[model samples]
Target: MQSSSFLAAILFFISAAFASDSVHKYQPDDAVDLWVNKVGPFRNPQETYNYYSLPFCHPSGDAAHKRRGLGEVLGGNELIDSQIDIKFQKPVGKTTICEIELDEAQVMQFKEAIDRDYLFEFFMDDLPLWGYVGDFHSKRKGDNQHMLFTHKSITVKYNKNHIIEVRLTQQNPKPLEVGRKLDMTYSVRWIPTNITFARRFDVYLDYPFFESQIHWFSIYNSLMMMFLAGLVSTILMRTLRNDYAKYAREDDDLETLERDASEESGWKLVHGDVFRTPFSIALLSALVGTGAQLAMLILLVILFAPVGMLYIGRGAIVTTFIVCYAFTSFISGYVSGGMYSQHGGKNWIKSMILTASLFPFMCFGIGFILNTVAIFYGSLAAIPFGTMVVVFVIWAFVSFPLALLGSVVGRNWSGAPNNPCRIKTIPRPIPEKNWYLKPSVVSIVGGLLPFGSVSIEMYFVFTSFWNYRVYYTYGFMLLIFLILLIVTVCVTIIGTYFLLNVENYHWQWTSFCSAASTSVYVFLYSIYYYCMKTTMSGFFQTSFYFGHTLMFCLGLGILCGATGYLGSNLFVRRIYRNIKCD
Candidate 1:
């Protein structure tokens, strides 16, 4: 049987080569060559030809490996050309690779019947975005089968012309198939960074949102988180930037001087009372770290998928969760501390304690409840109970103390640089309002709006992650992600603007309030989402539910908080740009 299969494969390759090679060399024919042609639906005894885009699903019922019907495959909008196009850059060694485009309908009718069930699902949950995924591996066919992945490489440009070209030392190659299913497997030689997925000032609609959110979240939240430690970093910089007080008639002149002076001041803008703000450091740490963590998770998937660690199987989220947690701890410490320092906050020790403590407590507490149910159901272990204890023990005993240790050290080490943002206090006996309407409480509520928008979509995202469903909609998820980022910034901006309008601007710390405020709504939305969408059973299911599900939802909350905080801070800075600070 093996010998027969091998012989048949050889015959098929020869036949495909003879048929395609006779065709025209559309563009500089000798410059590129058609190297391979392979068919799939491997289970069907009869050989047949087929093609489909990856993230191509396995057929339902018994239709597996069945060549798509000619009428259907050929029909417009019927998903006709399901294929992974492996466009070559430079032919490696002596191998030449080129396209063999055909009416997929014609090919289906031309072949013998076969099962149509073979397929592989692509995922974005554990990975980053790929410009294009196609199936084809390369090597030198003639003389010395050397690895051709090195040196002879090309950049993959998406949304470009059909004439995808690969430059090589111009050589002819044999025909072959890299993957049996319609999946695109790119080579290491392919460089994604060099090629702009955009041209003439446009990116995939998702790119703008990604850049906006990442940049906005990183910068502005640091400013908001500083509110608790209580030094308006902008204020501190102004005092330092204009140690000799001066007034300006126009905004641009003052803005220019401040920007230049700020650079020279050498005082990092994050300090003081900002660290004391409740939940600021704790949650901001979660967002910044989670963002960074997600980035790594993406790279790990793209760089190492074939090697088998990242998206390997059922245990993938476990690895992701651990990494996420570890990273969050570091970010929490850094963001909280940096902001505290900018506020000239004296409690570095206390700030660190809160940064390391708050998030873990909430995450672990919720995670524990869900994991317990998963264990009771007799499935996978929901993070070993022992591990939970170890985690908390470290948080309380190790992290909390280090924060205290750092706080003591910072207090003894120095004092706030002799400075004065001498805002002559305008004292006003503040009028009171209904508790629900108060700026502090209301702004918090205002913050949760985006979380409300996202909860519906989030349920499916996690279920797919835990249940081992192949999620191929990453390209779309990337789009949705962009929108959410915009929505987050908008929410934060509006919320902070409303608060500044109130007399209680004293509580400016809640600028992160927009994002943090949304967390409450997120929790509530999940309650509804869970009841409406899932019918989960067993501890394995529930633990997976808690481990995978809540993390995403809550982590999403953190993302909002960070985004909102940043947005509001910038708004404040822009508005107060001309306000006197000395």
Candidate 2:
């Protein structure tokens, strides 16, 4: 009976191999070497709470089919179906392999196909989405790992037989010549895969989409980050709550006195005080802040600049930093001035400078290390030293002035604005109680959870970006998007409940504390990712990496939990600050 079963299994395997058919067979059309395509202005895409336009569609403009995306895909509900034709011809008896490539001296340029422009569409189909990142570092269908923003699970599976070549153009960062011209560059080259899959090159169009066109690695990274971030926050916040509470309210003379004198805003009531912020929370905020600035910068540039749509890839990281930091400084100065004034952190000027310079220092240091490493390795795509200098000059000369202007404008508006609620100044201290956590503390804690929920995703993200991989998976990302929104909402609700339960009588102070905890978790996970995953070196390298990383975490934390924190704070301050209870 065993021998008969084995024979049947062998027969099934033989039949299955012959029955598979996913890839078609045909040779690539002629590969163009030189094409002078005209470029055009890009328009902006609509903004929504639960959506963002794909990079290929940003700055919404017309251009050559190279240099990035000439014909950008327009609006769609999350993921829409997309396709790329792959044609290849190997000797009937032999196999051919394929790989993704991103090596050249200049950017690829091309022309747009007016209205017939269906660049690519994806149908999200219930997958959660975060965001999309396209780096030309990976050119092979297989053989490449997710570099900076990808997941660990990136193995593509399909029935192999024939082949087709899906080609596109490449060019230089427009208006900057002195480099080689990019032609109809195949997004993926079947070379390394040639070695891996016996010279078989199944082609791939490197775009992040959902539905039938999802990439496994990209999806995994997004989901993983949120999971890790949430898990870590939950453990620390739940297990270490009492410890943090004591640390915040303990009889430490220094913390008590400092909290009394140097602070004024309701922060004195926040989860203890700034110093009481768990060492882990502080660190995460610092790191996630950097990523926040980066995200904001990219979004702004894409929304404002003429060429941002086509130029928002690869070399644009520096450009993003310049613009984001400039704009962020204004926000920092304005918000800090108001919050610190409310908190009673005297010296608004000092706070402004601190906010403005904080990210700048981080950017310079990291850029320095990355630039050095690129020089040492002789990577062709390395941002040039001259370009670096130019970028610095641009930031200082162009962006700095703009930031200064915005700060002044913000300061004026802050003063001019009417307080929605009247301020009452008097010695009204709350009676001692263990029920309600402080509002500042609550918000901060709440912020930390969202951060934790997303940290696990970073493991794959950093690896994808560092190792140089193409993370094109819209389906999984769409799923992630939904999950992220739901999880964020759930975590916020859970945190708020725990806080209200602890101090049902003092819901105000405890409200904000819950949200701020997520930021704390984000910082903790970053440390974990750094210590356990990344091989980055040097103080500058580590500091800069941490700084920008925190920026993203911080932004996400705030954006996700803003409604709860502010609403709770207003309720508390209005109802309790000057309540007529005698």
Candidate 3:
């Protein structure tokens, strides 16, 4: 009975979520809801505030608000019901909404909003419409006047019973004055259209920009780079094979053996120290584990988004990401635990804790700072206290426990040390090499190719996020992602081989950093993009833009770092496997 009740509850929850998003068929004279969403400056996309934050006329009594999902709240949406009475297929002529007695305070507010170029957003039957608050004009030299729009004209187009489009036009501009009596009025017109509801969002998609020749050319260039990276890897493998044959030849005379030993001063000389536990093994393991989880999470989201039409919903992407991250916490713990154990680490508790909280705590710290900024500015971007608590509960109860369970399972299953070479009792002293051969240099240079491979795609992704463009090309994104991974692995492998060739055994962190440095270049490019492409000004929008970009870079860094390390590990083991180790 308890199990049955639980299943029923789950089903009801799912149904409720889907039901709110389902299309509605309206009968003639049935009331349609107009939802007032948010208002913000035209230049700043993320800096939004509640619709009622401005001195707009409110409903006489208590107003109804729409309940939003987890994603919607995170995306900074607060939808309030606009009590404009309208019926389906019923056209209403100019009707007075309210009389706003403009006092000094209201005049000041209107002037400020006009100066900032604020725009209001409304939703009717799930279709969105936008209109500016007011405009400013110069009647003569040194004589400027601020005008407020007092009339709203809404045109709704429908096919049969389904609303297909909604448009808003602001009219009746009245000069702002201290004792002005401005009448707020609205008119609604219902028109029949042959367009279907499914094709309504097509108007918002910029197909020419997304599918241009430049975009396809970029993809082709990335593909060519991938093949080049593959060629480099194949060459490295062949060279390693030749070394293996020479080192494994037992019939060589003592004189020949001695000559060969004298000549072999590169990677072959460091076999004994190659498998030694790296410095800060626990932190490295945790980061790698987190990266693995992010890699899988991004792949899953990209695959699921197009298939499910996740773009149609307001906050569906964020909601899906949070839920998927929770479920995939197991992957983080599993990878961290196995890596820690394999490296002979004894602090199981520390490893588990770090694996679970590292990335999340970093994000939370950044979010806390950004949220404070939002709150100070009275922006709707500030996450509410209740939403924060809900996220915490989900992480604590669901993500943490799953991580713990995965750690235990991983420790028992794949924690055995299986290095191809044994660690020496004492570490070999790393000889100084040329400045160009240094780990720092190699790490920096290693990321160049990988960054180049995905640089074009990054521009598209950034524009879509910050410039109000819908990104529907997950297929292009997936291909670019795969190319990035391949290039990162191939480049890091080459870097690791060079480090080892210099008789350095600290290839682990070096390899990771080599690939992870791609994020540094990406962050720098974001700075350039911000300066050149966007006209956003003010502290709030600036902080949010760079803060979010930092978060993205951190995740990308971790993902690439982990992939590099894993690839290098395979390469190191393969090359050493056939060679005789002392």
In model 2, the worst 10-residue window by lDDT is 41-50
Residue lDDT tens for model 3, 1-582: 999999999998775443332445676777788999999998899999988887788877988988899999999988888899988889999999899888999899889988998988888776678999999777968777999999999998888877788899999999999998999999999999999877887877799999999889879889988888899989988888777777667324556777777565678789889999999998999999999999999999999999987877789999999999999999999998999999999998899999999999999999999999999999999999999999999999998888888788888898999998888898888988899999999999988889989999888999999987889999999999999999999999999998998999899999999999999999999999999999999999999999999999999999999999999998899888877776
Model 1 lDDT-worst window of ten? 123-132
For model 1, residues 523-573, the per-residue Cα lDDT tens digits are 666566556655554334445444544665566656656666656555555
Residue-wise lDDT of candidate 2 within 355-415, one digit each (tens)?
4555566556664665565345332223555555665676677555554544455555653
Better TM-score candidate (1, 2)? 1
Per-model CA lDDT versus the true structure: 0.41, 0.38, 0.89
The candidate, 2 or 3, that scores higher on TM-score is: 3
> How many steric clashes does model 3 contain?
0
Better of 2 and 3 by lDDT: 3
RMSD to the true structure for each prediction, in A, is 19.1, 20.0, 3.8
TM-score to true structure, per model: 0.44, 0.42, 0.94
Q: What is the lDDT of residue 219 in candidate 1?
A: 34
Ordered by TM-score, highest first, the candidates read 3, 1, 2
